[model samples]
Target: MPRVTIKEIARRAGVSKGAVSYALNGQPGVSDATRARVLKVAEELEWVPNRAARMLSAARSETFGLVLARTAKTLSEEPFYMGFIGGVESVLSTKGYALTIQVVPDLETEMAAYRKWSAERRVDAVIVVDLRVDDPRVPLLQKLELPALVVGDKSLAGGLTCVWTDSTTAMTEAVEHIAELGHQRIARVAGPPEHGHVWMRGQAFAAAADRLGLTGTVVHTDFSGDEGASVTRQLMTSGPDRPTAVIYDNDLMAVAGLGVIHELGLAVPDDVTIIAWDDSTLCRITHPTLSAMSHDVVEYGGRVAHHLFELLDGAEPAAHLNSTPKLQIRGSSGPPPA
Candidate 1:
């Protein structure tokens, strides 16, 4: 049988289509008995509201666009974007909105994708992530007057609203926690320096270490586990005074560093302690669970969506979020060995 319509429900319930609409929308004017009858009929027939028709009648696309800066091949190998996108999509689905996601290799290709989405009127708004210092997208978004939100703290205040985690605070707290563990020397496996968060967190790490009366060093990499393992090996193997505690920008590298520690015959929380940013299940599954600065990725995505809706409503306001990442102690961190 075909899907039931409101008209069929109204006919079966001996009511007008307008009465069915009123009852379905919970609007007044229909008698309680008639409303109940219409609703019962609709429920029995399994009728669903036509979201597409509703959006079209309102002259709105009810969709948003996301353009990725990496190639399709590279995207599959990365877990961060996948988890982040999943969170974003979950919120969009609940709001009866659609997400138009595209992948491009470079800035030029990303620009082309943006143009195509704009020319086709495919999205009501756009979300830009992985912001770098002096990103080209800043000027482009301003020129287009696009309703956009950036995921990092860039100098786009006059042009675009931004949503950022307090990477600086998180990094600072991680270093301080290690210092509290009596760790005097600290090292960080940091993301690329161009990215705004990476730079901010690196600077904050230094400041916090100084405040805590400790030494800090940061090794910049491409946010890859391979780079993390290599850097950890070099940092640990070739030093008269190697760091007793390490902080990582992401979980993948932290997991990789765990392997390096074991291979070098080092005991975690004994000879070395590790704390990672962006906690995930991989941390818990390791031999000794990794301690980390944790935040809710799902909630972060929902917040971005909430702000985008505000922007779409012609609200010319600036918004920034500094999510406080809390330290979750596990088997990976402890007081310095006596």
Candidate 2:
């Protein structure tokens, strides 16, 4: 028996060889109906993809790229991403794939990296993170016709496959818990408002505070320790009506805020309540261990990477919600001062 070629399939399907190629490689040129017909005909012929030939023809790099718009130091200190990358690596390595990570300083550089990676086929796909409101990267990745797994809400990704964590629920729960503890004045140390999750959390914070009749203020910061510390100090000393509780967007900022609270002669849970997101190791190591919104960040990363592979296998784009964060009460949180 002779091996089947795309040409034979094309001839039998009565479509052009180009259409057959597109259908076989799962490219966008052929319509679904036409692709289905081609696939059916190919199936009748018992056609199988030549892995080596397909790799060359489809320009499979067997690599996925993740570009971060942060310094190397930032990546090192950030526990969420570290665990996530490890999780992603666990899958990629098992599948005989490579993960190429790039650290860029700005969106421009990050976009440039995407363009270069796609054009050169340096990566077969990518995982997009830190999605901002009206994210330009979504459309760009689509324009480039590259496979991407957006680790953000579908609203932010604009039609990309999303593996998102529900931050709104988590933020609401955090605020409600603080309000229950009799904390009247609450301040949230949020990440930059331009980021989608950060903005969602802020909205949840405000809504929950208003509903619970608590004074709420959300201070946007850059998710940096310095900024976290600075904002904590400013909030603590700016006036007599200082916030009794602070919810940080990330564990790094929360840890920094804890130090700031101590420096200002305030104590955790007693004078000031602290809640950190991601529940990374920093949260556990802090004195009076930080209360946190806990979720398995490493598992989250694994889910995102796994989704990307599914997209590669021709999975349809959709929103996939991962595990929600559960508020873990620790020493950093208690009933507000009487």
**Which candidate number would show the highest TM-score if scored against the true structure?**
2
Q: Which pairs clash (backbone N, Cα, C closer than 3 Å) in model 2?
A: none
Deviating ranges (above 4 Å) for candidate 2? 1-56
Q: What lDDT tens digits, residue by residue, belong to model 1 across residues 11-94?
A: 899989999999999999999999999988888887877755665565567899999876575356455666677778888888
Give, for candidate 1, the lowest lDDT window spanning 10 residues: 71-80
Clashing residue pairs found in predicted model 1: none
State the TM-score for model 2.
0.83
| C-alpha root-mean-square deviation, candidate 2 | 10.0
Native RMSD of candidate 1 (Å): 5.9
**Model 2 lDDT on a 0 to 1 scale:** 0.90
What stretches of model 1 exceed 4 Å from their correct place? 1-59, 71-79, 154-158
Instruction: Give residue 170's error in model 2 in angstroms.
Output: 0.7
